[model samples]
Target: MTLVLKPLAEQVMVITGASSGIGLVAAKLAAARGAKVVLVARNDASLTEAVEAIRAAGGDAISAVADVGDIAAVRAAAAKAVGHYGRIDTWVNDAGSAIYAKLVDTPLDEHQRLFQTNYFGVVHGALTAIPYLRDTGGAIITVGSIASDLPSPILSAYAASKHAVKGFVDALRMELTADAVPIAITLIKPAGIDTPIAQHAANHVDGEALIPAPVYDPALVAEAILDAAEHVRRDITVGGAGRLQVLLGTHFPALLDRLAGVMIPAMSDKTRPKTESTTLFEPEQRGQERSGVQPGRKTSVYTAAERHPIALRSIALAGIAGATLLAFRRSRTRK
Candidate 1:
């Protein structure tokens, strides 16, 4: 089937986890770009508020309250999108929850719960959206994390769930290709973006749960998601530091592990009091963009790399050739 996706202005987008964080930003951005949007989340109140905000901005939007973790709920939500908008051109699995605890410290049930939302939720979204997307060849964008590439000390369960998400996305993409399916599957791995996730994460540590420095604005991630919806790429890392971390973990796994073991503990704030507020079992009502975490850096190298890969590769090759030539000349001079 020769599938050509519709333009954003003519497409209908369904974004899960649309009540807050990067998901909310992506919904707003997509609606602003002229796409009719369907917002899905577990919280009815927050979903209504998000829809209202989008409508207030003169964008077309509707809300469906569904927990992505539940297959039936996800399918119902997909049905609602199709019923209301007629069809879904883009489906984003951005609904996820995390836990801040050592693997041993985290309860088995808690770990299961986290995976239910992070991994199974994505699976449900993909499975439910695939049939609708298969006919027209649309996009499925899953929000993964840098943890998918490199495991973190305090967030082992969360990291593992992200790994599962990556695995599922990879295998599904391969299967779709083999079957000649026209759907575009994309995995977006973000570094610690400023999102309410940190505040809502279930923490089993001595201090308050927090995402470390070098945080990025959630808008950066939302932009990447929207871009993937329009121009489907297989994988995209959000922050420059995240790209660096992936590269290091890929090439120097042992060294990266050793460094992370020490850095993770040192970077965390141990003095802050632990909070009881968490969205592990239920959704929180705080509806806002930007996690309130001040970004440590203002630039995203990953975005730059993605936007100008050829130019960056050329520069890198030139540098390597120049160094090689200089080394040869010095060797001859020494001889």
Candidate 2:
């Protein structure tokens, strides 16, 4: 068995939204493991801080302040990574936003911005990485969500955006395989990690945030992401609940479709009333940045429903097993 591990010294990692949350944690882990990292995010200051922190910890890394919304900027960032490191081994499409509101309350450009980062940003990164990455069997990892797996009307746009990301990554994975490209694509689904994403969710005119979210730990997701990079698994679930949702949704597709309508509303305790706006990452509010890792929370475990893996094998197995058991029981009764 030939196990080809990504060489930490030669492997260069490019991460989006490295200024915070899972991206930040993932950067730390990669650096600790001896990979040269390139940090990309809108906040140049925060990106600098992350780079310095990593360097202080005896890790090699660089920072690029770029927004995923701009293809030129994304491409430039990718170029910059290769320039510094001479080669890029892994590229992660993690720049995304959840700032959303009711469909009726959504802005005309809401979907545009979502795709700018969520879908198009990934496309841009993938395109940028292709030329330089083709020879290295590089990996593309995108942080997806449970919302993508199971769409909900309340956050339809966010879910839709994620669904699009899933589609792109899935198709790209196969295309790369069929073409015999060494690059591996992985779609990472995270149920919820208590990142400041909710704080950054777009708000309406009434001070009410545009989207609501649940909490999940960022570190666990970071670990899972690194694991994916190492193993090149097609996809991974970041939470237990996420895993369950993928499982139940597959085994009982119709039932899940029906249940989602009844279940999605429970994700948030409150919804927007009137045109009020809410806090989302602008700071001085619920969206304040997390400076250091919190104590005792390095292990935020998710329920089965939250880790909605993009890979459907487990869900398929469960469906097949259930069907077989049901058929056996019916045959026995008839006999």
**Each candidate: how many clashes?**
0, 34
Best candidate, lDDT-wise?
1
Worst 10 residues of 2 by lDDT: 279-288
Give the Cα lDDT of each candidate: 0.86, 0.71
Predicted structure 2: lDDT: 0.71
Top candidate (TM-score): 1
User: What stretches of model 1 exceed 4 Å from their correct place?
Assistant: 1-3, 296-298, 325-335
- lDDT (tens digit, per residue) of candidate 1 on 149-171: 88788888998999999999999
Listed in order, each prediction's TM-score against the native is 0.94, 0.78
Residue 282 lDDT in model 1? 86
lDDT of 1: 0.86
Which regions of candidate 2 deviate over 4 angstroms? 1-5, 205-214, 250-335
Give the range of the ten consecutive residues with the poorest summed lDDT in model 1: 289-298
